[model samples]
Every structure is written in C-alpha cells, then in structure tokens.
Target: MTHLPPSEFTLAVRHETATLTVMIGGELDYGTSGDLLNEVSQQLTAGQPPPADVRLDFRELTYIDSSGLTALLMIHRRTSALGATLHLDNRPARLERMLHLTDVLDHLTAPPTRAGGWQPEEDDGLTEAGMT
Candidate 1:
C-alpha cells in the first residue's frame, strides 16, 4: 500500500550536558523521514565529540509507517556505531504499539524519569488493534 507524504512536521534541538534531544512532530513517513535523518546527521557531523546520548521525543507525532520505522532503525544503528545511546521519549500510544509489535522496542531506549521512579516495564509488543 502506498502512503501519502507527510503534510506537516517540525523539528527542534536542545542539549542537556552531553545529550542532544530532538523533538519530532507530525507524520514520520516516507516524505518526512529525510528531515529527521538530515537533522541527526548534521548533529553527528558537527564535530561535537559525538553526543553521549540522543533522545527522540515523539509525544506530538500522529503517524508512522514502515518507512518511518526504517528511518528510526537507521538512527539507532548510526548512534550505536558512534557509541552513543538513543532514547525515545513520550511516545504516543499508536506509535508505541507499532514499535512493540515489530519487536523493536527492546532495541530502543526510554526516557529517564524525573523523580527517579521505577522504570516502566517494556511493552508486550501488542497494538490496540490486536495486530502483532
């Protein structure tokens, strides 16, 4: 099935110590993944000792496709190769389900809790639609 190009999305960057956080919004499908990939590449190549950690905030994202998942995997591989950790933060329910069903959640990182609370258990790899 063909998916439409993303109509809207935004990217922002912030730093906390050696960690660089990239906040993403809107659809992350074929048409919009490049923007994310480019942003990551720029940060990695900017000569800043390779960020100790890279966090992707997807709280506002509304959609993601297989291509989008591929883009995220690419980011993971790139960061792993550079010896940096990649953290996924505040994922919306739909996207979280997709990641779990694909059995890739174990490969991704979650945001640290502010109050030093217990870590939530990893997702069971199930989506609300019951597709796995």
Candidate 2:
C-alpha cells in the first residue's frame, strides 16, 4: 500500500481591538486538531478582554477531519460562554460542505435560530374557534 505524507498544519493570527482572526492552512486531523485548540486557548487566556469576534480563516485550509470539526465546536462553545462570537470565514466549497454535512456550519458561523424565532403579540384566532 502506498503511504501518503502526513499533513502539514500552519496557523497565523491577527489581533485587533475587538476581533481576532486566525488563519489556518493544511490538514486538520486527529493528530493536529489539539494543536489548533491549544493555540486558540492561549490567545483567549491572554488576560485581555476576549475579542468580540474570534474568526477562523480557512482560505488556505486544505482538509479537516471529524476531530478537527470537534475542535472547532469546542472553540465555539468557549467563545459563546465568554460572550464572544465565533466565525468561520472564507471557507472553501468543500470545507463549507463538510461543515454543512456535519451540521456544524451554523454553530460556528451564526447563533442558532429558535424554532419560532419570533411570535406576534396577538395570538391566532384559535380561541375564537369553537374548539376553544
């Protein structure tokens, strides 16, 4: 069997007053997902206010496995708990599909919308119906 070379993972960060963008490249698999988490954790724990938005730029990311997806979920959870937004940016088509297929795209990019996102102040005429 032919063996493929291990994937290379690289990370870069750009920090602004209210935004932190992390650029990721290469593969994110079981072997490298932890490193991603660690890098994000370090920045979050740096004592300064957590950035209002923590964005992951996947413009150069080539691949990601389930473990990598889990890492993203973890970061999303932490950022939410800290009142920060988590954004997945510049996702390649495949990556976007991966996240969508795994049902994590919305979790990472936007807050979940409630089943009934809005309700009218007035109720429907159900009570007026004889069934009431």
Each candidate's TM vs. the true structure?
0.75, 0.77
lDDT of each: 0.72, 0.73
- Write one digit per residue (lDDT tens) for candidate 1, span 19-121: 8899999988777776787687678657657777899999889888887787787667667666677888999998889999999987866332222221122
- lDDT, candidate 2, equals 0.73
Deviation in Å, model 2, residue 35 alpha carbon: 0.5
Using TM-score as the measure, the top candidate is 2
Task: Give the per-residue Cα lDDT of candidate 2 at 33.
Answer: 79
Worst 10 residues of 2 by lDDT: 113-122
- lDDT of candidate 2 over 22-85, digit per residue (tens): 9999888777777787787677666566677899999988888777887888777666766678
Q: Against the true structure, whose lDDT is highest?
A: 2
Clashing pairs in 2: none
